[model samples]
Target: MPIRVDLLALEPNVPGRACLTVKKWQGGEEQLEFSIQRNQDGFYLQDQKAWSNNPFWFKVSRFALAASGEALEAQVGPEVVDPLLEGGANSQFQIELREQNLGHADKGVVRPGVGLLPSTAGGQTRSTYGGVDLSAPVVPEPEAEIPELPELFLPVAEPEPEPTPAPAEPVYTPPPAPVKKSKKGLIALLIVVLLLLAAGIGYWFYQRTPAPAPTVAAPAPAATNAEACTLDSMNSVPELTFVQTCIKAAPDSAKLLEIINQAKASKHCGVAQRLYANRAQAGDPLIANAYAREYDPKYLKASECFPTADNATAAYWYETILAQDPNNAEAKQRFEELQK
Candidate 1:
């Protein structure tokens, strides 16, 4: 709190409205600032109102007395000093500053207690060294406290969170495609070929089986007499060939029925059956009914020809008769019985 500066001059002998210079040592030279003499004080300052706290006192511990050199030794520097902010940190180096020369540190004689010793020179100092008034009060100036500096703050930036990666999709995997059985088509074709071959062989066999030729019946001898009309002479009748069929149709219907009945009664049942099969297939009403009378259930007796009382050669001829003559009661009843 001690002031270590030279007391060069005091203007008007008053503390009010005095322009003073504050000096600081930097690089071994002085830097001066416009300041105020707050009171009859130890240090030059800028303004008295800038300090609100009661001033603290620090005396110059360096020896002080009558002028020791030709230069004015105004002991006006700070006493009991250590740098609180050295390299921006608290430091602990004991220091004691003795004096400071404000500006024009020449010729002005020193004063012991009252700051800025009185002088007059060149209108800057209105009094000389010999003009100082020793009668004034030597009240020492009060010291001031250096206010602690407000702390500076800097903002720090924050890092952004990294985006999380999406989960990987499952890979698709499929089973190998099944091998097609190439032989299956060939096998099916072989079976179809074999079936066609078998059918061809059966058809060939059926074609090779020869049918019996119609019996080449001998010609019928002319009726030599009524004695030729006997049953034994009937065997000599012409074969029922195409020419003989015309000769038979040459007869009257009554004669044709008589001839057919004789052929039937002569035990030529095969020929009769053939006649019935042909007349039934030909849809002849009279011949089909006549044939029906032989084995028709309506006319049946205990005869082997009508076994099961079935109409002759199946009910085919009787069906043919009734198809043409539905009013014929015999054909209708016999056809119905054959249905059973």
Candidate 2:
């Protein structure tokens, strides 16, 4: 039986942070999860299982990684297959790898070791401020000189004769005292008037208020969540959500085909791509071939959801089919064409 490889998720921003699930069916089923990272030389596969300790490094050229396979071994070497098969090297063992969104990985850079090295400390001590004269001597400023003023002569007049002083008594006047009035009765009357006014306003408002209307029950929501999971229903946002939920629920091949047809008719490229990918990853050669054609240079269409044709991606899907059924003449021919 062939090994199954499925790409789970890939980080677009950090392309090296990709996860995959690999399963093999020979000699009792066994599966392993791995986190893939790229370095200068090639790719690194680290087993995600806690108990797994072996990590393998594949030279970039070995796996045709630039064109096809996700984690499959190249025809030349058993280095990749041996580790994956856990020493059960059946001559017939083959791996079908499915990947998506691998174009996000940046161009390779040279990191000479497995995994990422811790960032090194700063190389040299450097001053934060630049071009300062710290050694210059301090200079004292000179004080301003004062000039002497020449003396001037002036005449002084004699004081006027003293006038006779007369003492006048201050006029006696007393300020009027403020009058005090009793306000207890007035305050009490004002309080009583305010209370009466408030009571009258309250009574008026109470009489003017209208009675509550009878409660009319709302009609049932017409089982919106149960709306037929058709592609046409995708136009409704709520129904779209329901459709997505059902897609994830893993509908049968027939249901998937129905949805795929609806998607193509509606020009729902993204939905079609998703359905094709899901089915293709499940070892469905027919679905895989259909998906590969979507990216194939010859059959690809700009009007489809995939506006851009990618020969590399088409080759990858074709390689996946070939791995499963080596005698698939169509996949083999198209794969060779894409390679050239």
Mark the 10 consecutive residues where model 1 has the least summed lDDT.
81-90
Candidate 2 per-residue lDDT, tens place, 1-340, comes to 2344432322221112223333332221112222323221233443431112243322232232313333432231122322332211111112223222222111111111111111121221211011011122235697644333233232333464564464586555453332112244546566876777677767766765778868889774632433445654665544224334445456677767777767777776545654565567557787788778877879976654566566656776787799899999999999888777
lDDT of 1 at 55: 34
| Model 1 misplaced regions, further than 4 Å | 1-233, 237-239, 246-252, 301-308, 311-314, 327-329
TM-score of 2: 0.37
Top candidate (lDDT): 2
Worst 10 residues of 2 by lDDT: 108-117
Model 2 has an lDDT value of 0.44
